[model samples]
Target chain A: MSNAAIPVTEYSTPQRGWYKRNEIAITPWLFLAPGVFFFLVYVIFPIFQSFNLSLYRWDGLGQAEFIGMANYQELVSDRAFEVSLWNNLKWLILYLLAIPAGLFIALFLNQTVTGIRLYKSLFFFPFVISQIVVGLVFTWFYDPTFGLLNVMLGWVGLGPINVLGDPSIVTYGIIAAGLWPQTAYCMILYLTGLNAVDPEQIEAARLDGARGWRMLWYVIVPQLKPATFIAFVVTIIGALRSFDLISIMTNGGPFGTSRVLSFYMFEKALSEYGFRMGYGAAIAVVLFLIMLIFIAYFLWSMFQEERGR
Target chain B: MFPTPIEKTSRTWQITYQTFLPLALLLWLMPLLAVALFSIKPEADFVSGGYWSLPTYFAGLENYGRVFFQSDMPRYLLNSVLITIPTVIGCVILSSMTGFALGIYRFRSNIWIFFMFVAGNFVPFQILMVPVRDLTLDLGLYNTKTGLVLFHIAFQTGFCTLFMRNFIRALPFALIEAARVEGIAEWRIFWYVVLPLMKPAMAALAVLIFTFIWNDYFWAVVLTQGAESQPVTAGITSFNAQYRAAYHLMSAGSIVAALPPVAMFFLMQKHFIAGLTLGAVK
Candidate 1:
């Protein structure tokens, strides 16, 4: 009995010692291992792979051949790429309108009244539903024959204009549809920011005889910087990621005028155009580079904040 | 407060603001309202071009019945449920663990690892498309619900971890320190102490992830195909293609596809907003 008890006690003590010695160092890795593995395999690794793939030539089914910047050279002269890039620029510019529009709406609704909570949510309804639904809704609304837009135009003795079919205006039409939901998102962010604004600052500004736009521009807007920054980041990201709506509404119709980088990449990679995997990868790389500029800024800012803390 | 409250303004201004509120909402929601109206209208109305006019008769029953029974919608919805529930559970579990590790510990690589997740979350999906699809194919998971669920869980972990880590950071560290002082095992402290406190954060992440996965159309199209595995978003798009002029049926399908997320949003409004506006306030 004494011998058996001694062994048990000895074994237990070392096991405890082992755990105690490495607990802080070992425990976190235990928690993080699965997540880090998945992220590296799926996200981080793919980024480098995509960049490497951009230098090769392949049809997705055949053996990939290293072409050493041939696809990138071709991209320089590709008319379709030009159109898509220009359209993306248009989308980026026009989509920024949502920030100011959202702020306007948020200010209008930032009141103390009965049923205001319900009103705020109702205004946010567009964002809750799927982009596919938004696409369909806007398509019907923009229909030349029986669309609400045309009906409203008829009241003004105006257009039965085919918005989607007109290449010159198609991107604008899609961006407008995109703005409906995006504006609501921005509005919510600003509303939250507005909630946290110091009442004393506003009172101080009021005592100094500030009012209206000046008051908003100087006092309120400065306080809303965090909201504005987030809105700006998300809006820029959303603009770059304009795929679903374009796919659903137009499919890059009217001679491929409304194509953005995202949709164009998909078309090259996997649509009826036949799979040009290498070329598609190159296109994706270009888009990634553009995004990297913003992401770098974002990360730098975040890092500064982290260090500050 | 910045704009000055409507009640504190003149009577005329208050009256005008009240009048303008509903009108603006109606205009903003007109497209959705139109779709809802179209879903209940009979086929004859679209044929007669009475799109704006009041429906001659309400055919809500027939349209919804046709969508549920005659189409591939039910299968698609089931696929969505299969894909989304697993994704939500996996993301929550993975993120919670990662978040706890990042939030509680002060390792040399903590901030770098955290930044990796934040940056990865914002990368355009196209960059991941070819590789992710190829990986799924290699694993024999192509065109499968499991495949979609796996990718979604991994991708969403980036955002979820960011959210959860920040949330846990905000939690009082004293509780955890006390648990350690009492000689609780590390894992047990996580389970018995921290896990229960993470309920609100978990609920918030669950709602946000549910909406994101449910409303996903791009990845659904890229990863899955046909009625067998495609979620409702992709399925409904194909449905629209097949029934080219069947506006009533198409509208009904869209509504059916959109209902779950809408219901989820209304049910978890506070959590949803809280999850979305994580860093905006401060």
Candidate 2:
């Protein structure tokens, strides 16, 4: 509004000509320059640097010796790496239960009940708090002696269970803790999706005697594809990126049973374990590849939408 | 609607749902409620092995006082505020500019550039872990709050830009077109014509980024160490390691560390949810 007061022909002819000639070509870059510079330096450059570091032998401070494929070969036989990879697979598969669980909660809460708004916000409480706090809360909850889980199990005449201590069930336990917050995230997404579901189609389905599971399956599910897609992508990313919980809860303890690639990479690179920068970078590259598979699909779908627009 | 409203169902079913609602909520929030309870209990209560029982005496003030006065929690909290405020400001500023450019302009590489930002936002921090740390060390910024803030601002810009660009795209295009016809400088148009319209986006992004950077634990551990620079998230973990079996103190520290973001979430609930659900909605 302020700029509208300036007359169009008031500027000097040469300056006006230059502004007209080069402004379109130069201005956008000027706007994008700071953002693109920082993003490239911090995000884009590091991806390649990490990939290149994976092919070397460097302990972060020492001379970088080019040892091609040696780190990769070492990773192929590393037992801890194998366990971490397997645990990551388990997290990916089991974390998916959040979708159905979230949809169930969303369907239940999608009504005009009084105080439902407060209930919805309270349900989202888990996602707002730090995962470190969640990890601590669950660690205490899973305490073997006098812990809530054991106390509850005692009601059923079952023995106390060491949730984080037993190597076999440790990963599952951590994943369950992760699912608490993740399920809330998905529920909010579905609630948004449910709000936008077409009422005409639902009314038609109701008239056709589509009810219960059939109504939800045939009528509601199709309309929620966008929400489902976002939920799946985020869950996969969240599962693969599982680090804070493991670090805070167990530190990949009980013989490294719960180590996902993210935590294992940090452990190798910077923890008490001597810094093998090359080897840790190798672990990160592997994790990156796993993520890139899904990221590629996500980007492709997004590209299709951009083109559709 | 899909489940059939409880009011239309039999009275027994309606009563059952009403009864079941609170029970299910209790089960869902059991862990958090337990922690909230533990935060108030005196240390003697834990020693008695009555973990599930009501606290023998409340020690909320004592525990919280010890955390603030005796521990390094105050310094860690100050560090979080210092780190989070700058990152939020930096990211929102940078992304708004980038968002304005990408959102309002017709360019050849727009979609590709936009995809780069989108894709970068999803990549695991592990891939950037080694190089970022190395870069920080070389710059003599390792163990400094500034280093962490810089990294966060740069990384968060990707997501913020995606959000801001989409937001600007949804704004009325005619405003920019009119400004251009009036012979306004392109930057002037952005400053005068478009930026004022971005106040809501700015607010939403600020709250969301504040929560994200405050709740960040991985980078705090990766970039900074100890009480000198670590945020409250990492500080609480180390505090736990120091206290060992002192669950009461740990619970107090955890609650303190978790409060800022939780408060931010409640205060800006609408904007936070809008920012998160932006792409998920049609």
**Per-model TM-score versus the true fold:** 0.97, 0.96
Candidate 1 chain A, poorest ten consecutive residues by summed lDDT = A1-10
Score candidate 2 by DockQ.
Answer: 0.60
Number of the top candidate by DockQ? Answer: 2
Off by over 4 Å in 1: A1-15
Instruction: List TM-score (chain A only) for every prediction.
Output: 0.94, 0.94
Candidate 2 lDDT over A1-309, as tens digits, reads 122222344444764566566677667789999999999999999999999999999988879999999999999999999999999999999999999999999998887677788888888889999999999999999999867998999999999999999999999999999999999999999988898888888888989989988889889999999899999988999999899999999999998898999999999999999899999999999999999999999999888887777
Q: How many angstroms is residue A71 displaced in model 2 relative to the true structure, after the best TM-score fit? A: 0.5
Error of 1 at B217 (Å): 1.0
